[model samples]
Target: MPLTAALLVTVPVFLQAPWVRSAPMAAALFTLPLLALALVLERRGQGQWQQLGVLLVGFCGSWLGGCLFWGWFRLHPVMHLPIEAFALPLAVAGLGGRWRLAGAFYLGSLLGTACTDGVMAAAGLMDLWPQVLNAPLSEAPLLLQGAAIQVLHPWPLALVGLTASLLVFVCRRLWTLGGTWRVTAAALGTTLAVDTLFLAAALVAPHLSGLI
Candidate 1:
């Protein structure tokens, strides 16, 4: 699961490189590694195929839901976060085990996606449309210039981490309160950890590479 998480977190960053971004099939090619890793992980009994499938579907559904909602109502992007936070847990709940792992991976993807944007922004490598809608809405000016990461300021990222952590900790205390509360805590906690790791990478990698 950790390996899968790592791959999920790093793949987006890999895809953001100029050379990979230029290749029409780069995204598909990059996904191959994840597919391979998923297969290996499943074989090792790290997680079931159903869980992985659920995670992927839930993750994709979150984006699709956002797009559809945005298209229909054009709500502020800030509104979409709550929608996703609500929808994702519901989407994974049916899987019936420690499904928070799925949420972790899903959120990990968000982190990777964010880090990828940050790297592109620092390197001036972004040339395509923003890969995630949040980037355009949150960092409109940067998007216009074919850059990314303008929205990845530390405070907002830290706030998200703090919120997720608080929710998870609070939920843990509520486990005896109900199943729903327990699940919610797991989902929020896992998501928070994954997001923190990615945010840390996004903030630090640029400095390490002298891109900032």
Candidate 2:
């Protein structure tokens, strides 16, 4: 779990670096090593193949979604959030009786995202909240704008932590539902719920303002 967490946290940070960020293929290429590691680790476990399937499905879904929305269609990167969030959990839930594994993937992914954002904010690469909230819903990629990191604020951290916890709780509950359709419904609903909560917090809260 620790190794997995480390990979999850590190992969996003590495991919988001200015040079890699400018090169989409490089970012995708860098993810391969981590994906390989994840596969090796899961193969040693009980649900080895199932877990591997989950990882592959998640990666493909996220990559394809990114290509379609952020690349071909030119949608705002912010709009990709819910799709990226839904893909992994939905794949895990598809495993039917393996809610524990699904929950682990869901939590791990959220932890990774939060850790990446925190690290980027600390390194003065980006302002955490405004980059998310003020993101244009048209064609801009949020992290590539070269905006100076704004003054560190406490509220966004608190809000992010709160939202992460809430998402975990919701996912855990979703895992308890029976049937693939039920799980899918729960996963998609939770995705929208969390995204909405994040957007609302970023927009309505004064202390969380950014250059957007």
Q: Which runs of model 2 end up more than 4 angstroms from their true locations?
A: 16-20, 29-77, 86-89, 92-103, 110-212
**TM-score, model 1 to reference:** 0.35
In angstroms, the error of model 2 at 81 is: 1.3
Candidate 1: list runs displaced more than 4 Å.
1-47, 63-164, 170-187, 207-212
lDDT of each: 0.42, 0.43
Candidate 2 per-residue lDDT, tens place, 48-166, comes to: 46554444434444444343443322334344445445556565564565444444444444443444444445545453334443465442233332222222246544555565576
- Please provide TM-scores, in order, for all candidate models, with all chains considered together: 0.35, 0.38
Question: Best lDDT goes to which candidate?
Answer: 2
What is the per-residue lDDT of model 1 for residues 109-146, given as tens digits with 9 covering 90 to 100?
A: 44333443344344443433333333434454333323
Best by TM-score: 2
